[model samples]
Target chain A: MTDHRPDAGQPVTAVGEVRAGGSPDGGRLDYGGPWRRVSRKYVGVVVAESIVTGVVLAGISLFFALVIGAWFGWWMLGASVLVTVVLLVVAPRRARAIGFQLRDDDLLFRQGIMFFRIVAVPYGRMQLIDINRGPLARVLGLSDLKFVTAAASTGVSIPGLPAAEADKLRDRLVALAESRRSGL
Target chain B: MSEAGGGGAQRPVAPAAVRRAVEQLTDGKWHRLHWASPLLKGGIAFIAILAFVLANLRERLVELVIGQTGGPAGPGGGGRGGGGGGDAGRTFNGDPISAIYETGFTGVAILIVIGVLLLAVALFAVAWRMHSFRIGADAVEVRSGVVFRHNRQARLDRIQGIHITRPLFARLFGAARIELNVAGQDAKVELSYLGSRQVDELRRELLRRASGVQRAEAAAAVVAATTRSSAPLSAAGTSAGVVGAAPAATTSSPAEQSREAGILNRRVQELLGPELDLDAAPPESVVKISPLRLIGSLVVSEFTLVLLLVVAALFFSTFVLHRYFILFLLLPSVLGSLGYYVRRFSKAARYSIAATSDGVRVGFGLLSTSNDTLPPGRIHAIEVTQPILWRPMGWWMIRINRAGHASGRGGSSAPHTLLLPVGRLADVEKVLALLLPGLAGADTQGLVMEGLVARGRAASGFSRAPRRAQWLRPFSWGRTGLARTDDAVLLRTGFFWRRLTVLPLARLQSVRVSQGPVRRMLDIAELHFNTIAGPVRAELGVIDRRAAVAVFTEVSAAAVEALRADGSHRWAS
Candidate 1:
């Protein structure tokens, strides 16, 4: 009965009891209650990854231009710089778009701005919960939580949670999954 | 361990032969598979590797001939594979099989093959010795690998189904592969190359054991049903089943009773059975598609249309355009299509659907026959589709989704997934009854019929998409709808290819309602019923936003209730 998918352009509202790392208008995307946003530090990880990739691409183009005597090197350099700039610009919005809500019966996961997808994975059907952290994510103290279900296409993963929050959510989810363990 | 799963003391006593067979395994002693397990399982991979080695040897031999005849690096040299046309022509002469066969045991090819065979035997022998399985009260455990151990346990309560596969080569040795499918991503628990009879016996015993989880709540519900103003219909059915089960245990009617024999001398009715009753199956259960109709459907298909066009063009190029050269390139493709047509035809020749005591058996194939059992409630979803080509003939194809990868066969070109290739409306009804016993109700049957073909009936009881939603689905908007029954939900969609999907509530993993930018603008949404991966994509699109929310809540609640009441997970018990 709740308007779970409020418009992305809705004005910021008071988060009330929910505080998810200063996400703007996080309260507006509430499904009965406010959604929990991922850590904003995730933007840094994306930016850093983009910069490293850009440097590699620029170097490859430089090598071609200076060493291999290739004319397309200039075009390749332009493309890589344009891509890195676009990636840097969208990193924050992409992070903001990622949010999750833990309802009584199921955990709802949502991501993507242009082509959005919202998945509901029932607690009773959780098979396993895994926590993963890459070198960059680990440096930023962020963990990505993934849970498996009997269905191959459940595709439920929540990235960019602060380490402590990720651990707490895992514990709560494990308890919920076990207590209501309905075999597929 | 046996007591841990708790099938309750009042569990139905299995048939004596089945009980004895099960007892041998459930004693918790580890058992090794058949001696041929190594040879049969490794044969394919070994042959593949040998073929690769032999092909290389053959190429080297060809090169030697080329080097000797044409001398080193001739002026006409091309790619390494491009041996001079004359040398290559003399060797194969368009028949590769005969070229190999004619060579026989005359040369290094034979020696290399023999040596590889010996080494493979030695390695696989070790692998066979390493792999062992044990059946405990609650789980079937398998352990393999030498240095790096691989231990897998399939909980009996979580078993989806057990399937016996006899691949073409394995059948020559009267061997079968047993794969125990459970509900998880990495699901197979395989025991390869068991003797045919042993496989039958083992599969039966395994199913009975796996389906032994306790149903205390179900028993309580039955007792309550009988006592609280007894529901006459179910009470009668229960009493009748009880009466039948009683006589089954003490099988011999008093006068014919002989001295009780031990397990060693067990006789009269203890032979292992095949999955299908191909010989004496009743008329009602047997579904045989006529060859004429099969060919007719093929003629009307897109595949045949393409083939016809290719042939027509080939003829046009050869005659009208006076281009004989095109024949060389196009001739093989025509022949390949013909070969494909024959293969598809053979898949339908001996196809039969029969109901066995174990489950509904679907048997097909001409030479290396394969059939598997699907017990009641194992089916999660059923989809009946009518492609525009088959609409005139009123033919429908049925595909199903079960928990395991083994089940489902009804779509195009997937082995063991197509439940039915093509059938009439009445045939679909009969097959539906076999898969979903809950559809036996008259009301449910009516709903199914309406769902199948209710294009003009506005009052057909299905919740259709709003007229405004036609912005999305122009042609299919009138027919695309969602309906529900107590047992399952029916989602209808498609115009050019009509599809009706029925997903049981108990089988639903979760419920999701999604709205995209366009749908949000149109005040509509899409509802998806999450289920295990299979052919049936069970989702309803272009539904009104309000209805989507209402159905989402309703399904979530109903699914929870269905889970509480579902005893299908342990159907036999």
Candidate 2:
């Protein structure tokens, strides 16, 4: 209120001078942002999926009416269209809210649009952690982290991390897990 | 530049080489080839797609038909003109117009279309999602995601063997498929589209990595064991640094570090075999059956099936062809041949054998490669098994007792080990070098004789206690108080092959005591060694309850003491 902007007589601070990011002493921090966004890239898959769904339902609706004369088919077709439209509109925002947290000891993730879910994987249990960037994911400057453990038949997956961050996390996680397993 | 100078300059590039090697090893383009079998996979996809298209078309047709027919105009009358108009004017419920609307066929048609369509979409999505894979450091990870994405990651350590093959077309395309037989994991990891050179490099890197880790761990364990055993002599003069989690000893020393690496590699190799018949008659012995003998055995063993097939073919002729009764005989032979081929294929495989300071590594397998590394110190006990067949062949199989065995059962089937199958006395000595280094120079024949003597003692009247236990013996005719053991009962049943079993009290999960009326009356007792091997338990029976109790108590106490010592050592090391 009293001269918010620094004058020549007072000490002036640059915008960049303020500690902006997080724990600037270089300690690990959980940096999260909205992950799911309907970009031009993912739209193709979404549209294809929706159309496939619509067509299949329409066929079933006709067949039942023609043969057994069931009433559920028409409802199913209408529901499919409604669901596809809702998902297409709402999915991006939901995905954006979902993200992961990293700590020295564990990698944690929280996802799901309607029903929230949180999964925490201890470093010691991680058999392997890889950061993969597919052709599309690479172009979009995003990466997915795959956390594999020996406990499950198939390894666990954590998607939608920044590519650079994902790689750093992968290396640190592997080193920590292996070291902990050896009781080091 | 001098060679040394050139090499010095390349030292900085060494890490890059390692990264490149990792990249090369993990670049498994072969998984794409799995889609080639799309006959089954692709057929399902095609069906799903067809259903989708058909459903769409059906819905449109039904909607159009219903819209035209269900109109308020006289049913069929206005739409088709003259004849149809007259039919539409004819009776419809009570009124011609309302009857057509009341039938509900229009609504039913719409329902059927939607139902089929949803199912088709779900099926397609599931199939597409399931066809995913990832390349990893140790093995390939493949998973399918839909409703529940099936995920499986194989350990390169347990890969027992590998097979590199190319179909006619694959060969022309300069790509080969690699099939790995990994143990522990049920499913195999197939890499289908790798180049020949890549396959070679991949195989070598995996092998090298596995062996390197195995050798290192074995060496460290051996050193530790040796130090533990020998340091007792100098315990008073100097602290062995093995007490109370000493800071220096607890932190992994240079030697221990190397040994740990070796063990890891060995573990990777063992994880590679998938077709490993855990139930197969021991892996140490490689049985060779000549092709002629193999065929002869097949014919002789399956004589009944063959005869049935022949009779059916002769009498039924066209009926047999239509019914496929001949397939029964053919199927067995084909399966048997395949099994035989698998075994034979394994025999020809070469595995790098290493003896480290800690343990011994026996790596073998092609399609399902595996490396088993056993640290001598970790072995609680050793048992030599002689199957009825092996008895005639003068072959013995040695198995070790250990903890945390995946085998849920106890005893012979308790997931112990198969050390040797058909080794001579000298081979046994060679193996004992790593298994029981302290006894490397000990007499193998003498030990065998000692085992035979022990068996005899059990089967005969070696030690007779009080007269109360005579009836407890299997067929004891002698009138004695404390009866002799089973070794005395089976003295006359000696054969060429002797089975010597050593049960370490430390690995014993429990000691179970059972007694019948005769046993109670004669004061006889039976003690069972409960281990992790499922179903097949090891039991030692005797005619004297007192003797049994003493042995049981002593073994149990010893095991507990050893375990406590091991725990402390683990903490200290």
Q: Backbone clashes in each candidate structure, one number apiece?
A: 6, 100
Please write out the lDDT profile of model 2 over residues A1-184, one tens digit for every residue.
0111211222232211122123332311122322222123333333444566667766777677666678876676677678767766765545453444344344445444443333444555465666776665666665767876533322345555556656766777777677545210
Local distance difference test scores for all models: 0.65, 0.42
lDDT of 2 by residue, B1-573 (tens): 011011112123333343354354456532333323323334446679778767754654554456558865434533321112223333333532234434535355446657887776667545643555555545667666566767777665545444455444444334445655443333466655454334433554455443334344445663454344443222211111122122233333432332333333223333343232111112222222234533332333334465566566645754545756556646566557556544543433443333432234454444434444443334444555444444433444456544324444442112225555334444453444345432121233244334433433343333333445434443332212122121111111113334454443333333344454445545555555544342233554443554554544444444344333332112112
Model 2 DockQ class = incorrect
Misplaced by over 4 Å in model 1 are A1-32, A42-94, A112-114, A134-136, B1-134, B141-152, B167-174, B184-186, B213-286, B317-330, B356-358, B406-415, B438-445, B456-459
B225, model 2: CA deviation in Å? 11
Interface alpha-carbon RMSD, every candidate: 6.1, 24.1
Best by DockQ: 1
Spell out the clash pairs found in candidate 1: B408-B417, B409-B417, B409-B418, B410-B417, B410-B418, B410-B419
Which candidate number has the best TM-score?
1
Please report how far candidate 2 places residue B117 from its true position, in Å. Answer: 22
Q: Which lDDT tens digits does candidate 1 get at residues B1-573?
A: 221112112244334433454456467887666666676677878689778868866775676576667764433322322222332323344444325534543355566768987887788778877887887766889899877889998887677666677667677666677777775544768877565545666665565555442232235442342233122123223322232333334343321211222111111122223322222212123567888887777677888888889889999999999898889998998898887767777776567775443456686766556666665467778899988989989999898887766334343223355688788997787666555552222355567777887764263868888998789998888788888787678888888899988888877877776767787677677778888788889988788766776677678767766766665555534
Cα lDDT of candidate 2 equals 0.42
